[model samples]
Target chain A: MWLTSKIKQLLMVMKPGVVTLNYPHERPPVPANLRGQPVFDHQKCIGCGGCSDHCPARCILVRDVCQELRVMLYDGSRCTYCGRCADICPEQAITMSNSFEIACDQKEDITTRMELFMMTCQRCGRCYEMEKTNAIDRINLKGFRYDNLEQRALIRKTSETFDPTLLQQSDQYQRPSTKE
Target chain B: MSKRKELEAKLIARLRDDVVCVEKTDPRTIFIDVKRAGIREASKIITNAGARYLCSVGYDNIERDGTLGMIHTFALDDSDQFVCCRTSAPENDAIIESITPDLPSAGWSEREVTDLLGLRFAGHPKPKKLVLADDWPDGIYPLRKDVPHNLVPKGAEDVAYELDEAPPGTKIVPVGPFHPSLHEPEHFAVYVDGETIKGCDYRGFMTHRGIEKLCTTQISYNEVPFIAERICGICGSVHATAFSQAVESAAGLVIPRRAEFIRTMMLEFERIHSNLLWLGVAGHLIGFDTVFMQAWRVREQIMWLCERLTGNRKTYGMILVGGVRRDITPEIADDIRRVMKTIEDDLAIIHRAIEKDTSIHKRTKGVGTITKQQALDWSLVGPVARARGVDIDARRDHPYAAYDEMKFEVPVLDSCDVWATLVIRVIETFEAIKIVRQCLEKMPGGEFFVEMKDSIPAQRHAITVVEAPRGESVHYVITGEDNRPERWRVRAPTFPNLQAVPLMLLDEQFGDFPIIMGSIDPCFSCTDRVAVVDLQTGQASSISKAELDALSRQQQARHASLKG
Candidate 1:
């Protein structure tokens, strides 16, 4: 009877297959609803600083460097990643990304800088880069020289409004050379 | 029905200090405010009324009243009333007569007051540092009005929580801020005479995050819950829910009925997981590999459910002020119900196996018996208090969140041993399951959160208590004009219960010390440590893990040889 009981216990141990994950080699499956670091959609950003103000950790810095409203930065360090910013985003522009493995050697690498493109100015009828326009058009950009001023302005304006049609428009309407 | 009235009448008549106000706070407890000179006489009068002195804590009331306030509680055995005798002293002369002579448990309480508030405990035996580091600057109490807000009390000091000069024959054993045996970081110096622990003094200053101070400085009222939740890795939800409830009560914010149900669900889920974790640890401590494996296997079920529902296995970031971060959908609720069924089946088997194990009986039975009277006098709470038959559970007594609607039983046992505590926890797991089931069925659908529109008023104070898995978590919030608590006291349950460990471990075997300490369910992250010294300086060799293992091996070999 004791031998049978011992065999039964052994069978209980042997009944299960190996359940441990190969953690590093093959990544374990994360749940669909896992709340990770906040991912900011630069295209939808209004530069209202709502996400920054709502963030308890104050890890986000959204500033209109001049007035183009695209100069935004988020610091991974000091961010609790509590999903508050994602939860409070009016535009659904901020969502928690499933990228928890965020480690870097340098301080600059930690504060990931994701810049947004400028949309076409409705009033100017000319394409201008959001950040570059804020620097050059709005803030009297004299310190930094632009080589291809028109192209830079076009790229900035297209990025600001974030219209896919703007990229198609750029392809269709290329500027004619002055000599031609 | 008039039991409270009768007690109040007696207190009023006996004291005869018409100047001080005495009011019944609870059914059997009276709150009394007397002059500093009247404390001793008042305490004696209350004690004569079949009351035992619980503990005295000093609060820095300079911002409000320009004086330091000391409050103490005395309780009766049969009655629920604990007469709270309070007195105040000026900032310069913050002194109080020590009540250690009347009540031995007040030894640690007086030491805490002395360390935190810089109060002089007159004629207290060994009023050394209890919770502060030894090298903490003299006259700079972290909880004092004079100490400017920013400076934290730091550095190791020469004070031991319980100072014991090692006897000439006894050898001192130091077990770590970093030891294999200790899962948490704590420095414990054990003075052992052979196998018996002559004195065990714990000192730790490593895990100090200054969480309380951080809560006050950085987080807003709505955001404070989530910030406080990150204090401990294990019981994050408990801290978060408790802190949130406290702020909600203070602000008079009416939480959505659905939000209350979600909060209760989260809290019970936490209790189940935490208790399961403890069961695993206890099993591991007693050298029961199979039992440990079984406990952990069941624990993973709960962990999986937590991860699925709240998105984290450990820290469930599901708490928000006036609401929860995420509400459980119908599909997710079904998954939780399924998970609960599996856990219930596993727990039934585990419970029977644990109860039948002779090794468990040998190891835990009558090992750390804290009698009913001692438990009450020490102001102990949670399963530890319940095991000793003190009959105090914050969940039942102080109904917060949706607990008022939920039907569940609070597990209590009179054994007062390690076994009794284990039984209470086991029973509580079922109660937690009952709560979770009720919550799932009754979860209402509504908006999860309310927008904080009003700014925090300045100079307004509010006290709120919530039942965490461990015990009552009290949060004292004093809001500033800018809508943030200028001074927030995040009083976790572990802070008070950790005080009773030294008293519990008295006369216990050195080998059994770890298990006894573990029985209390201590959270060392909130606690500050002090370094203890052996006054008699001689290089004495101590017991090592290798030596202990070798001895056990030899004993096993001898037994096998004799049987052969």
Candidate 2:
């Protein structure tokens, strides 16, 4: 019985011969639907901040440098590549590229920064419209978002207008420390 | 009378004034609110009515009513229904009776509740900080509404968890934090005399990321499926589907038929890969590298297939609250069928090769043996319980997703050992392939994703179960304001199965520890670190990898000599 079993195992092992791929030299073609690092189209973006609000990882941060310009930053270091931003983008500005080999030394290589020009609402200073019926899909952070860009911190607090005091407070935003 | 009414009548008859009220949230779910004093008796009555214990869920209700709530959930598999016994206590005097004395599986749940929510269980056996670190400051329960999700309290140095006392005359062998055999970070102190095991004590949850608290406080409903998928690398779709189903049930949302079929196919794909993965790992644990290599090679096809279908290899992120995110095109369906065919043929070849191998039988047969009654007592699930002849499969019983229309066989064995688990997993892989074929053939044409018309009303509770490849995964969700769940509790399959490890490890050969633990296919990737300590002399030492390998080899040599 042992000999027969060994013979069968030998056949099984011999059938699948040398399946390992030689990577870096011989590359396999990636599928069309692979959700890799996301690429942002600056001209197509509307500065709605929908992708930032819907992001599960919160890797995308939206900050308003002024009333006219909104800086959207994608920190690839923490990105999960689940592609929620691409799915939720209203203008189809975000696309999950086919680039799976994104290993690099600096985070800036994979990161994408977009400076979008915004047109504010005439009735209100903010650019957001509360017209969506579903409350969960609505963008909660309206007006100028003053997230700390240097610290890569998403300050959940926002102002109705571009307030320098709030921006300065955000600049001093340190993580909550343990009470001694 | 219906099964729900019959159970409700029995509970109300037994505890007349203690039965507060009974509410049926849906047809299959019955929520019975009993007074805190009669919880034990109520649980007994439900169990007497043939209800299998699932898990306990504890949540903070202090902000609204100054009370803490506890719900003990059970499944009436014979009748296809669920019975949830709900009871709460005031925050000032939060003490509830522990059901662990009767249902041993509730031990971890109650301890976890005590650690996270600060709700004490009066008669809990060995309730010494299950989920919290030893140095975690008291009076700071992280699950409460007022506590922030990102609170990092100061860590007190030099404090360590006090493990249970080793049995008399048995040497302690600490098997993890980082052992060669264990892929995850969990510590098991096994008491052994010579080559035989006496008892075991486990200290895990070291890598608990507080996901429940994060999802409840930080993220919204739509984003939770993605986070929930990260709960387990192997069964990502299972957690995501269960969470989405729980929310959908709570909101009374009816998804499209095509979406259900797609969800079912995704779940089956996960089962195929996961079972094959377990098979390979089991082989590796038993020192049989041939089976490991062959099984994993067969599984790689499914991985590539999933990457094409769901846009990633694992964590499909395909499921949402209303429906699935991706639609199955005809070409993708053909691709799935082709992959399933190749996997079926290759797995059969591997199965035939290993089925009659004497070496595998010598290693796995009669190892990790637990009786059917003991398995039921610990509320073990999946292949572990099925191997022990406790026939329960959530897919057929609960019929979630598109399983109600699909027909498949659930293989059960009476061997009650690791060999049976291996055989059952292989058979179930074949069955999963069959289910995927049925799903593709019978899939209806409709919308893949649906938009929620209205906002989910707050304070509605729902529970859902999805049969992960490992076992039954239960998810309970309560809708809250701010588009997030008020309190979401996830009970992974490993939660109950791992609790019964000590019972399975009793009286087994010490050298067979790795294969025995690996028999359950524990998803311990979230856990890390290892140390060895002598309980009698109070001396701490770390065992090197070479020493552990030598020790195991020595034991194996002794066993072989005795057999010869």
Candidate 3:
């Protein structure tokens, strides 16, 4: 019984000889739909902040510098590459590029920053376009957000309109102290 | 009368006025609110009615009612229903009667709630610190509504978890927080008398990332499926599907039929890959490299196919709250069929090779024997339970997604050992292939994704179970004011199966430890540092990674010399 089993095992081993790829040297073709690093189109962006609202990892940050300008920063260091931002983008501005080979020495290599010129709505003073049919898709944080871009922190505070005091306060945002 | 009404009548008859109310949330779920004093009696009544104990869920209701809520969930498998016994205690006096005395499997759930929510289980047998770090400060329960999600408390040095006392005339052998045999960072202190094992104690959840708390507080309901998919590396789609179904059931959302078929296919794909991965790991545990190599070689096709079907290779990110993100195009369906055929042929060759091997039989045949009664007591799931003859499969019993229409056989073996688990997994792999083919053939054409018409109402509770490749994964959700859930509890299969390791290790050879533990297919991550202490002298000191590596090399050399 042992001998017969050994012979069968030998056949199994010989059948799949050397199936591993030679990785970097002999590259396999990546599929077209592979969710890799996300790229943002600054020209097509409407500063809606839908992607930032829907992001699971909270890697995308939206800060309204003023009524006219909005700063969107994609911190690649914490990004899960789940392609959720690309899926939730109202405009076809965010695309998941097939760039899986994105290991880098500097964080800035993969990070994307988009500064868009916003055309604010006269009624709300914010540029977000809510889904007319589904109320659940509405953005939670309205008006203007003052997220700290330098520290990569989401302040979770918003004003009715763009507030200078809030922007200045968030610029010096520190992590909640343990000493309290 | 229906099973729900019948069970409610039984509970009411036994508990009398202690049964506060019975609410049938859905066709398959019955939520019974009982007084805190009669929780143990209520659980006993339910168990006597042939309902299997699932897991316990605890949440903070102090803001609204000044009480802490606890729900003990159970599955009436024969009737395709779930019975959730809900009870609460005021914040000033938050104590509940322990159900672990009646059902041993409730031990971890009660201990976890105690550690996280500060709800004391009065008569829990061994309620040591289960989920929290030793240095975590007292009187600061992290699961409460007042606690912030990102609070990091100060860490205390020289803290160690106390292991259970070894049996008389037996020495304790520690295997991992970083042992070579264990792929993950779990610590098992095995007690042995010479070469025969006496008992064992496990201290895991070392890599618990507080995912449940984070999802409840930070992310929305729609974003949680992605986070839930990341709970386990192997069963990504299983957790995602389970969480989505929980939310869908809570909001009374009916998904399209094609979406259900696609979800079924994705689950079967995961099962196929996971079973083959376990087969490979099992072979490697028994020192058979050929089986490991050939099995994984066959399993690689499915990973690539998933990469094409979904976007990524693992963590498919395909499942959402309403439905799946990607549709099964006809071309992709054909591609799946081609891959399935190739995998079936290759796996058959490997199975025939390993089935009658004497070396494997010697290693695994009677190594981890546990009776079916012990399995029932521990409430084991998946292949582990099926191997020991506790015939239960959540897919067939509960019939989630498209499984109600699919035809397949759940194989049960009575050998009650590691060998039976191996055989069961192989047969299940073939069964998974059959399910996938049937999904492709019977898939209806319709919309894959559904848009939620309105925001989910608050305080609606739902429970869902998806049979993951490893075992059954139970997800419980309660909708909150915000887009996120009020409380989401995830019970992975390893949570219960690992508790029974001490029982399975009794009277077995110490060398068979790796295969026995590997049979459960434990999924966890690694830890960086290790501390060594001399129990005799009461002295403790830390060891550097370099010294630990050199010591392990020396041990390996000594072991090889003895074998030679």
Best prediction by lDDT: 2
Task: Tell me the whole-model lDDT of each prediction, alpha carbons only.
Answer: 0.66, 0.88, 0.87
Query: In candidate 3, what are the lDDT values of residues B376-429, reduced to their tens digit?
Result: 999999999999999899999999999999999999999999999999999999
DockQ, 0 to 1 scale, candidate 2: 0.44
Query: Could you give candidate 2's per-residue lDDT for residues A7-91 as a string of tens digits?
Result: 9999999988988789878887699999998999998888888788788888899888777888999999779999988977767
Model 1 TM-score (2 dp): 0.77
Q: Residues B1-564, candidate 1, lDDT per residue (tens digit)?
A: 465455456656766663277665333345677878767767776777776554565677787777887776654545444456778888788787777777666676678778778777787987776666655667667666555434534444244355467766888898887676676678888878888766667665456555555555444555666677776666787778777765665566778899889888888988888888888788787776666676778888888788777777777778877678787898998999999998887787677655756667888998887678778777787888888897866676656789889999987889888888888888899999999999988877888766455544465444455666666665555565434566665556676677677667666787787788888777777443211211222234786645654665576677547433
Segments of candidate 1 deviating more than 4 angstroms: A1-12, A43-73, A88-92, A114-180, B1-11, B14-33, B40-58, B63-65, B71-87, B99-110, B144-162, B167-169, B528-564
The top-ranked prediction according to DockQ is 3
TM-score of each candidate's B chain against the true B chain: 0.82, 0.93, 0.93
Residue A74 miss distance in model 3 (angstroms): 0.7
Docking quality band of candidate 1, CAPRI definitions: incorrect
Q: Which structure is stronger by DockQ: 1 or 2? A: 2
Candidate 2 residue-wise lDDT, B64-140, digit = tens? 89999999999999888999999999999999999899999999899989988999999998889888878788888
Error in Å for residue B148 of model 2: 0.6
lDDT of 1 by residue, A26-82 (tens): 887677777776777877764444455445665665323222324456777667777
Note each model's CA RMSD in angstroms: 13.7, 7.4, 6.2
